[model samples]
Target: MLIPITREKFEQLIPLIATGPQYAYFWGKLPMVLKRLLISVVALVVIFLLGLAFGEGFYFFRLLFSIIAGLYWFWGPIYWASRRNLEIRRYKYSGFWRGRVLDVFVTDEIVGTEETVSNRGELVIVENRERRLNVEVGDETGFTTIMQGPLRRTHKGIAEGQVVEMLILSNQPDLGRIAKTSDIYIPRLNIWVSDYPYLQRVIFAQVSSQLSEAEERDYPDNRAVINRRRRR
Candidate 1:
């Protein structure tokens, strides 16, 4: 059964969806990066002090070892932290929701398209509907490209007017303002995924189940009220 959802529902779902598996995968790696950076800084300071106190003979070897150890400690954590921050920024604006079937439109021509890269070096392409509707989805931090493989290509072909529910990432309006004239204008909408068949199905099923339980709990039958009304 198709559950009717409001704009409020969409707003509520945004935070949950943003913090889901797709996001956790990125965020979980951040702490490791921070740890690596901390280790690197400490090692560099220690090596410098050791060289100053011990003189030339062992200093070069100690410095080299510290550099190597620092790289080892730093590489993985830095990579993961950067990726997590990027994902957080991307989804900070958008979320997923179930909505009633809206009107669908179609177009033969392709509209606007842009491409960006994730910290993992994965490429993401964003395309917009040609209509000048003031639709905003993501924030200044940017959007994480969620789809992979063939599914991404399928969305690339989305026609002009479609009623499909979109996973959109839009900016927070309160943060909207031009900080500097030459600053790159981060559009309010950062990332959107208009097509993801399996993920959509799973998320909708979970939401539907939760909503059903909530509705049942909130609306119980009242037999006493019915009989009293009949007697009156």
Candidate 2:
């Protein structure tokens, strides 16, 4: 199913900025972010004292400190958050599409633990087994792709032949090629799967119903035409 929505509407329905529920994940980074913030503050104090010592060159040193301080913002926690958000937003996508799941495959793989070790190239803890689900889905255009997400929630119930939806990033209006995808939504199950929280859940829920209804009204008219021509 493909619904025509303006790019402005896309940005509105699926905001580029993070929402409330996602802040919980950011809270996990508080310890690491605060640790870095303290280190940066210390550097500022040191630079200021050094600037005072310079006396004649104090103006030059002050400007140098300001430059470093400004650069630290982009180098710090905000930088990490922005990059993570970008992965969710990804390429320029136009069509909002839905497809049917063709297959479901699950596997266990090593994944990183949430625990953090203090600075100076801290150690990263790894877990032995993390379940991952690879679900292959296809749209009306006959384009298929595997969508992967962690095994959790009601996701275990997701099976073959179920409706699956996502943002379609392709140049061709017909969406002949799918280069990238956003979060996957299963309306019937009311479940979503993605590595990150990208959509505005509340707004998307309101819009999903309308799209699902529109999908119900839509028929495979083009498929019928193709079959008739082949018969002729």
Candidate 3:
């Protein structure tokens, strides 16, 4: 199911700081205002203690502390806003959606990473080979897209017919099409796969509940609904 969303609403769902696992793994599971308040209180208290510790007689120390405090107060919010914008900047519009995995194509590929070697030698960069699971998912909307993530990247027995839920985006909303995806959560497996954090996880879960309730309310056939994406 795909539910249309406004840009403003979408931005409001994004987080200012990383929230540890939940509806979306990369995103946090806290309210935006609450997270901001917590960050502010902590940042202020830590800065205040440091400021006092710098002492009253040292002008140099005072100046340094002031700079540090100002930077602390200023950096995070600004940086987060810019990052969130970058996440959605390419997207002209997006949708809150839930769907199922149609197919899985797993293949091993060469991947490189900087790994420290614990031997008579030192740190060495090595090429890491890993399997990639390409999850092809779709809804009744007649649109299908592949969501790639690092990302539970390995093959973990994810098979066809499992429910895959996430947010989908499009460069154009009037067209009512899906071009990109993020924050994929498999409810049955209780796993979140994504290249980057996207939706506010808490809100996502609430929306999921609402969607489920609506589905139950609208009684349909007892038979299963197979997702088919009309080929363009």
Model 1 per-residue lDDT tens digits across residues 1-232: 1233444544444322333443333333545467667777787788878887888887668868787767855354345544543443343333332221222233333455668897899999976444221212222244212121212222333332222233333454332331211001111112234311213334444554565456556654654533332232
Tell me which of candidates 1 and 2 scores higher on TM-score: 2
**What is the Cα-based lDDT of residue 46 in candidate 3?**
70
Model 3 Cα lDDT, one tens digit per residue, 1-232: 6777777766666644444432233222344445555666676577667667866665566566556555543355455645664766567787777777888776676755557786878878777777666788887776787866652533485777677778777887663666767767776665666655676666777666676666656745521342121110
Query: Which run of 10 residues does model 1 get worst, by summed lDDT?
Result: 180-189
lDDT of each: 0.40, 0.67, 0.63
What lDDT, from 0 to 1, does candidate 2 have?
A: 0.67
Residue-level lDDT tens digits of model 2 in 153-178: 68878887777767766655655666
Question: Model 3: residues >4 Å from true position, as ranges?
Answer: 20-85, 109-125, 151-157, 219-232
Ranking of all predicted structures according to lDDT, beginning with the best and ending with the worst? 2, 3, 1
Using TM-score as the measure, the top candidate is 2
